[model samples]
Target: MRMRKILPACVLSCCLTGLMAPAAFADGCPDQEIAVETLKMKRAEDSEKAGKLKEAFNAAKTVAWECLGNDAGKRREALIKRVGRTLGDQEEKQGRLKEAFDWYLAAGLEADADRVMLKRANAKPDDTNAVGNAIDHFKRRNNEARVREMRGIAARNVDKWLTAEDKAFAARKDSREELGKARDWVYYAEAGSGKVTERAEKRGDTLATDDARRSIENAIAYYQFADKPQKAKGVRDKARKLGDEHARKGENKLAVEFYSLAGDDAKAAALEKKSEAEKQKTESARQDKFKKDQQSLEKELGL
Candidate 1:
């Protein structure tokens, strides 16, 4: 096109071109000939080779912040994670905890940011909200051990916050859409001490066990009414566990109830038979006592 636009590579890297670098990057990427994302990766990689870690981080972060979508999500995600994490280390080394936390989030590496959340959690054992917040990142990462650890902290506190969360689901329990929310609350609450099925079976505390039973029952009702068979089936699996445990513990009625709810007709039928036999034996004993009492009354009255 223009003569000035036709410069050789050496002429482009002169002081004039070097001074133009920032403006050129600002106006558009350095190379319009290459694909934008590829050019961006090259810029960051070049900065890294030159030991300009911040520049490299900024280049990759620009893509993450501005260019993210199907392409970046598929292709450039690892590069974004790398540069962001590398810069986060630098920031943390400089004692910029908040900055490091921000960088970790930008990298989509919430597990790294969890290190900062853990600090706040340790600082405030009684702060259930803090523990709850700390658990969320690990939950996203599917780190069950860390989530349980955070929930354990929340369990010890047992403040109004947890009660509010527990009651929130109860408040909206009747709506079909809200049942999943109820299950979520139950998951968080019972996951702390034990799962709802486990708690129901333990029978260690009357209030806790009753609450678990009611929650599971309500969940079953909601699932049936909502036609959510898959979710219902999952809860039924929980019911099976409770049924076996109750049977082992000699709670025949509860065992039969749970087994029926679990759709285990054979187990339910067996338990029901045992329960019926026990009922008949108790009735026979009652009749024998009644006859003995009648005879005593007649003898005492000289009838």
Candidate 2:
């Protein structure tokens, strides 16, 4: 009975040793499962760096699962780093810049993140977009030392440009105001001239009145300054009509002056011819009447 109990105890001890020896060995060194997972992860990262994306992805997946199963802390860290770098590379190649940046940052590689972000900023879609992207990247890296200075320079340039624009706008506004004042002056001057012309006409001095006539001429000049050529022409025509009427009244010198004032050279010449003919007729009539009277007197006296 004693031999039977000893034999059974020895067999049970051997079975226990068999189980505890492997556990001891595993505890003393790295676990075989973890080691295998680490090797696979390393191979995957190497392949990825060599531009073998598909192979890297497959190997990384396998290592990740194995590391999880083995509950290996160091191996898990390595796997995560490898997978993150591979994802970052793939995202960069595919033009997914933000995603690439996130993956590189997760892998604890800030330098890579910065490089990728700068690339994205450079690939901006429009003029206003690049500044926003560059700012974002610099902020992410905590690199604000020079960013503020750059921002200040940009602000200063904008302020200078805005100042110039404001000056130009003010100059344009002033010009427009001056033009408006000139137009108003022309309107009032024309109205005053019209009133003066009407008064002069009622007083029978429409053509002979120098002051009122001068006002009408000034009014036409002001209308031209106001860019109203049609209105100016109308006023000039009225002045010409009044002057022509004065010229036809047998006022020889006065008619010449009026016709000249009316700018009617042809009418003035005709009127001058008529005046000359009238003078000759008056002289001839006076001579004829004197001769007749003298002849009658001599007959009466029987001389």
Candidate 3:
């Protein structure tokens, strides 16, 4: 009878110990399931920060599903939101604008969806489809105020683009007229005899209006036609000065024509004396300008 009682007590104690062992192990440390899920969530967050959006999305999805499976209501909700946000971000980075917007909407971020839709609408200027889509998204969010504003902006942008196109065409036409006037000035200013006034009237004072090409051409005509050597020298000197001014301003093409009109033979003699003197002056000026510019740029950059 003693042995039977002892055996029954041993069996009961073993069963209780078996039951308590799992509980003891479970209590000794943090919850393994929650710990694993948290680690995954952290991994996802790190990946996201490192710009590995796709991997982050996968990990976040796993965490969200696990939390949901465990019946963690608040945690599940939060994880779902995080997963949706991560996926949406990934889609956006990949240029899947519509997909990203949908995900944001699913995550209950209507404002974010609207913002992305607006960006998408702006990207495709000619595509009315994108604009229509954005409008639909705004409507779904009940953002009537924003929808109306965007519609106005779209209409304004279309009108602005049309006006700009018309202006560009007009500018091109004006440039052609200016070029023709420049050519006429060159012709008239070159003519030595006859009524210089009549020729001048036809071309007008187009050269005086800062038309560098016309001015240079007129200067050339004067150098070629002047009979007296003294008059020629004076005209050539004036032309040379104009050339130098244009060269300093980096208008090399206009400068070349004027310089050529100064006559090649005269230039060769002057070059030897002027080159070294001009170099020293230009270098000094450049150094001063560079220092000033560096100071200005540093201030602008907040460096």
Candidate 4:
């Protein structure tokens, strides 16, 4: 048989510990990891102080990743959050709303995202793409509150646009080009209102119908400001078509408004009567729900 025997205890212990040394050293990160990460943090702070915020954000993100990879994630959470917030602020200052929102979301700051998006929506009335992108982002996240806030922002911005267009049209009332611009703004504002109305109606929200009505009124005014009735005839025909579609869907109020715009006075009057009746019925339903809720609450209170 081959000679086989256990090593001395002291020698075995030394050999085993030697074998574990590298692992233990790894568990306790190398000095270089710590030193490099620390230096990166310092660099980030210095860059921020120097107003080179983009560089600061990048360096700080590197530190965050290093800490996460080194088993220091919990210890570095606050630092990561701080870095993310700083990145959002820096990007917002640079007028990069989408980037700011992304950083705010990364920082776990939903409220900050909402605030920044609201600011962006309010500031970029003429920038349709920006507003549309922000709306789509909120919608995809199923952020109903932010969507509502954005809708208000959109409606308010539409109002501003309509006001500006109206002023422009008034100044150049005889210009067909100006009239065309007015028409375009009215369409834009109405489309914005329709978006708000659609979303709100889905949620049973009774809000902002006034905004839609105002847009419709402005649209009609734009038609009046046009050089010839023929210039507005296409829009009028479209309105009538829309009215008929709404009527088929039992949306008599909208039908009435559109028919009136299309100069179908008889149809408008008939639809207005039906619309009033529908409004009363809806109000009665709401009151019934409120009363039932009150009765349930009173019963629960033994009153």
Worst 10 residues of 4 by lDDT: 200-209
RMSD values for the candidates in order, in angstroms, are 19.1, 26.8, 21.6, 24.0
Write model 1 residue lDDT over 1-303, tens digit each, in one string: 576676764586696767865533423434342357667767877887897877877787665423334554454566667878888888878877667877888888887888866775676665545566667767887889888887766554433333443454457443333233323444445543233333222222222223256656666665454455676677778888999999999998888888887889999998899889999999999999999999999999999
- Report the lDDT tens digits of candidate 2 across residue range 1-303: 999989999999999988877532343445776577668867876887787865765676566443434554455456557667878998999999888988887776678887786677556522234445556567665788534533443344333433443454355321223233323332322223333233223222222233346545644544554455665566656667766666666556666654554567877788889888989999999999999999999999998
lDDT of each: 0.65, 0.58, 0.59, 0.63
CA shift of 219, model 4, Å: 19
* Ordering by TM-score: 4, 1, 3, 2
Q: Model 4: per-residue lDDT, tens digit, 1-303?
A: 223344466678899898877532233567667667767777877877787866765676677444335444443455556767888988999999878988988767778987887788778855666666667777877987766665655556655654554465456432234334333443434445443223222221121122254444444454444333453565566677878998999878788888887788999998888778879999999999999999999999999
TM-score of 4: 0.40
Winning candidate number (lDDT):
1
Which parts of model 2 are misplaced by more than 4 Å? Answer: 1-51, 54-107, 115-128, 146-150, 153-303
Worst 10 residues of 2 by lDDT: 199-208
**Candidate closer to the true structure by TM-score (higher is better), 1 or 3:** 1
Stronger candidate by TM-score (2 vs 3): 3
Candidate 1: how large is its RMSD? 19.1
